[model samples]
Target: MNMKRLLTVVLAVVLSTAFVIAQEKTVDGPVITFESDSKDFGDIKQGDKVENVFKFENTGKAPLIISNVAATCGCTVPSWPKEPIAPGKKAEIKVSFNSAGKMGKQNSVVRIYSNASEPIEKVSLISNVLPK
Candidate 1:
């Protein structure tokens, strides 16, 4: 009888652990999934600035908070929504690529810090610039 009780307890513990692990597998925060991971401007002219808006969805169970957004260089500027994105809601990130003093194939990244389970998300932009 004692051996049977011990086996049952072990089985219960194993089941509990498995349940916890399965829950942890899902993302816990903003879940900032984007429509596209990268954008290509194709061709641009020097001395001109190009802007693109990235669309994203909050696919998590909780409110998604974008703590910060950073650019790869000073020539790239990014603007993200300041408000919390509720579950199933959408948001946008506006990026401006400055071409002054820059040419050739230009690639930049936007690092996003969020209060989500992943904590960090990266989006990239690429373009080719020629002299005007």
Candidate 2:
């Protein structure tokens, strides 16, 4: 009788451990994952206008809301989504750079503000400008 009771207790412990291990761990909150954070516009002529898109996805469990996008200077302009991005959805920020009256080796950074696991993110545009 003692042997059977010991066997049942061990089986119960094994089943309890298996049930706990099988439970899923859910992550709570929004996460922004960018495909690429920076783009290089190599060897461009002065007075040239260029643009690049920085694509990102919401990888977390909650919605991602992008409130604003700010550029380092007026020479660089950024446009982004104004609505909430659902989880598993993709979005982009379009940055336009004007090399007019500018010189060589420009790094334009745009700041992204949103309600995510990370509140702020950055993307940059790089170019080596040659005078016309």
Candidate 3:
């Protein structure tokens, strides 16, 4: 009877440990929430440089790490935070579009690479360049 009780206790402890491990593994990482993903510069003169700031927050359990920020074209430049954004903290991505050679309805894309729930997030910049 004592041997059976010991085996049962051991099995219960093992099962409890496995359940805890599974729960921890199921926990998710960081989540990124953006205030606005698209920005419109409206009507702008040619050769004018327009800029916009995209704000975001990390709303998850773990820290947010941004690996890279890239623009679709050279005319569009993006700058993002270098360090990790702690959970519940905010960050901004600065995007600039030079309308020097671009004309008409211009649309630019910026891609953000991160360890958030969504690995890649894209933002857009739009503008209408008027003649100088």
Score residue 57 of candidate 3 by CA lDDT.
96
| Candidate 3 regions with alpha-carbon error over 4 angstroms | 1-27
Q: Please list the Cα RMSD from the true structure of every candidate, rounded to 1 decimal place.
A: 4.8, 6.1, 7.8
**Deviation (Å) of 51 in candidate 2:** 0.4
The sequence of per-residue lDDT tens digits that candidate 1 reaches over residues 1-132 is: 999999999999999999999887666656888998789998899988888899999999899989899998999999998999999999999998988998899999999999887898988889999999
lDDT of 2 by residue, 30-80 (tens): 888999999998999999999999999999999999989999999999999
The stretch of ten residues in a row with the least summed lDDT in candidate 1 is 24-33
- List candidate 2 stretches off by more than 4 Å: 1-27
Model 3 agreement with the true structure over 1-132: per-residue lDDT tens digits:
999999999999999999998888343799889999999989999999999999999988899999999999999999999999999999999999999987899999999999988899999999999999
Model 3 earns a TM-score of 0.78
Please give the distance, in angstroms, between residue 102's alpha carbon in candidate 2 and its true position after superposition: 0.8
Scored against the true structure, residue 7 in model 3 reaches a CA lDDT of 100
Candidate 3: count of backbone clashes, pairs at least 3 residues apart or interchain: 0
Question: What does candidate 1 score in Cα RMSD to the true structure?
Answer: 4.8
Query: Which residue pairs of candidate 3 clash?
Result: none
